[model samples]
Target: MAVDIRTQGLQKPVSVAEYLFARLYEIGIRSVHGVPGDFNLVALDFLPKAKLKWVGSVNELNAAYAADGYARTNGIGALITTFGVGELSAMNGIAGSFSEHVPVVHIVGCPSTVSQRNGMLLHHTLGNGDFSVFANMSSQVTCELAKLNKPAEIADQIDNALRECWIRSRPVYLMLPTDMVEKKIEGARLDQPIDLSEPPNDPEREDYVVDVVLRYLHAAKNPVMLVDACAIRHRVLGEVRDLIEKTKLPVFVTPMGKGAIDESSPTYGGVYAGTGSQPGVAERVESSDLVLSIGALKSDFNTTGFSYRTSQLKTIDFHSTHCVVRYSEYPGVTMRGVLRKVTERVDVGKLAKQHEVTKVVNEVAENRDSSDTITQAFFWPRVGEYLKENDIVVTETGTANFGIWETKYPRGVTGVTQILWGSIGWSLPAAQGAALAAKDMGVDRRTILFVGDGSFQLTCQEVAVMIRHNLKITIFLIYNEGFTIERFIHGMEAEYNDISRWQYTEVPTVFGASDKQVRKFIVKTKHELEKLLTDKEFNEAGGLQFVELWMPKEDAPRALRITTEVAARNNAKAE
Candidate 1:
């Protein structure tokens, strides 16, 4: 690719968009998810010319979710929006991406450098002293945040943003002032493997980790592997699974990390925290002598708010920091690098025998189906039936939501979730973005969306976009009257938890089709949901279709325990 070059004095500079996009191409990103804005005109101008498609979004929140799905599936996700209003709108989604350990680049165009120097009021701002304060607010949500303030500092600034995100493993932000774009600067070197810090580890914590892991490894009669989604994002699933397979440790997943290893494996203990989580899974973790938690977060939902645990005394918690042993609550070895080394020492033959034993236990749990009101007891296995070898699924947060659907994804199906944000209303918009990607990739597989009513309402407008493009998607909407997770919180049960209910199946026709294009279905019971999923009329529809299933407004699900725990902690922190 070649571009305009301008020379000034002896200093070297480049267009801000060129500098940023070059960094992106260097990192192997070819497509981005975003809605164009006047502030980001430079990107809008150059991205298409560089053969990058701007996957437009209906709203900022959806933009974040869409970007997240793209990045999660394809390895690098990008989102661009205008200044204050746009950035603020996207905060929640990007934060969720951060929580899920998705490597996403958020590029926002802001008031030009000169506009900042004028100190004049801009439209739709909070009247804060400095316009850059908006970036500070975004800083609270992103992993790394910065403003490209001067012509000379732009290259190093962009480089630092990419490098820090690469090093620390979280979302990062680059706030671009309009004027600084397209300024001639040295051809900024793109972000590469060579441009990062040494392993971010605390050398002082090595002994702490050494003692804890070895104790657990030796003491475990039935050790279990608790892998969270972060482990997959860190690209350590194979290594972690290798350790588990070698040691023959049974494995379980948090909702965020579902399907990290083949859930069908004999050693799989099943999902520990979600609507469809197996009962024995949690009890087994609590009963075990050791719990090897790899990249597993003790989130409110993922861990029942960390309320439940395996052997508290001998627990092995591996995260971004040191391996923390429960005995002293002290940091140990840098969990990332140390896990690589320790897993290598595991015994494969012994591990295989252990897996055989767990396989029997797993079969028993899988066979005990019931008609109780438990949602996980109801939906997950059915989800497993619908998935194909190359299907893609997107989930949104809500009551009786996608949290615990025991889905059996085919060999390469990508499961996308908003583990960090966990906010309702992300699925529909995100599914639209994912569909766009599927179209772009020319993959014939269908996209499935498991969404809650509350979340669907938030991003329902995007259905028109899906229909306009004739994207293939199957949406299973869980119809609950309110935010199911909120009711789990202590005092949010009454008016605050209630949400307006709409004619759910009528949504697709209402939003996506005129008299001629809309096709829809109403699923009052499980049978209807099953039929719609299987019937050719429903599945083969080229335009848009909606399937609505009525669910209890009050039935307690496992994720509720998680939400209650996390919400309380967050609320307490707020206080």
Candidate 2:
């Protein structure tokens, strides 16, 4: 049913672009990221009118990655691109957002409806006059697709797509024909905010599931709580914390769930990724009689090559859309309500009597060697000590991602990684987006990034975007001379893993940052690294800081070493 604009007391009609941008502003998007193209150029004009800043990125792919990062921090993000070429270039990044459950609105400015009706050959198209091809490709990765052809229906379509993107926590594709940019739509519709609330779970079903969970939870002598990435993606940290604090159960996080829990908590155990767990973490988790797994995503990298020893018979899983009690499944019963109800109804006295709270002490290995060279074992722990609360840390897929497992974060810290997607060049642009978001939200949180030299080369130009926005980000570029993580897997000495060396410290200046606006450092020895880490001026620099930390080509994080070996064996077996 079409909504009658005149009946809604709407006297003025706004262009489709105006209506779209206004809705984005209402949803908390302050900055729009993308490149300028012929089709989207007019739509870009409406950004300023909507009180949205345009973050012109180096390319479409990086723009999508930045949108992913922005969405992670700002709650929701949007991007604008041209018809075919622009949207296709951003496919990989959009796919990453889909796989990792990030909410991003990918708006593509396409050809005019007249051009499409006549089957006109477009410059950015596949040269087949087939305009629907690109949108078809995007449909595979995006949760919702909105094609704006009619002015009357365009407003509703945009609202529905954005609603789906937010509620599902995934990317959505919006195709706006160039001709529709000026087509007037009902502006009064913007007065009503899109309903962003998650649908309430069935009350009766929720009660039954909560009872089943409590029965197992109270019956087990050894019960533990395991947290994972979906907990953060689905916005259930508060509920998870409530359950943990009320129950006082031993809480552990998986690798992808690094920053999900406050590590400073007394009952907080270290990361547990099966055999890749910290010291005794695997033993404690696997031996538990009842394991309450919250928002668990058991990916290969997250589980250390599928090495979880915990049995399904002993586990009860809490998910965003469903709950599982051992082998029985309850669909549509989300964790947000269940966890909250469980925390309220759980018998704290009975739990305390049934199980003894075991404090898992996180022990960092000391630098036994008197040599001045920096090692992975020493660097990660030292970095952990340097990190402050509420900091945003972005790590690349290779070594930095796995190395972060050893670095216990402070309370309130947020981690950004692509373990499931494993995109190499994601963190640089992501860090830029995160820093920009922090600035926009007026939060004093510092944005930090850790990227390998090989991965950095892929999207190093994004540093220019950071400089353009004057984001105060700290970047630690590991100079290992090659892909260290790949070497551990199969290419121990392959030339394909090697990368050309560059003066990494000179990047900020080349990226248009003034000397006062940037700080650069090169640390080879342990002494040099320690001095830089402790320097108050370096830590509190008013502008961007880039450090080239030199490590041996062969050295890799302990967790990375084990997981890669397992991956190699699996690949060989498949061959």
Best prediction by TM-score: 2
lDDT of each: 0.69, 0.90
* Tens-place lDDT digits, model 2, residues 488-544: 997889999999989999988888888888888999998899899899987775679
Per-candidate TM-scores read 0.84, 0.97
| RMSD (CA, Å), each prediction | 4.7, 2.5
> What would you estimate as the lDDT of candidate 2?
0.90
Q: Residues 1-575, candidate 1: write the lDDT tens digits.
A: 56544444424355678767877766656667677778887767878655676666677877887777766666667889888889888888888777777778899988788888886688746775478777888787678887888767777778788876765667899988888777766662442343654364564465445544765576567677788877877676767866765676788777778757676676776667632345666567667777788887766666555556455575677776556676655553456666765665544444323534242122214524444332544566566666776667887775534444345555667777775567678777777777777776676767778787777778887786677667778787877777777776755568877779798777667664675566666666655666666887665546555667666676545455555767677778843
In candidate 2, which residue pairs clash? none
Clash count, predicted structure 2: 0
Best-performing candidate as measured by lDDT? 2
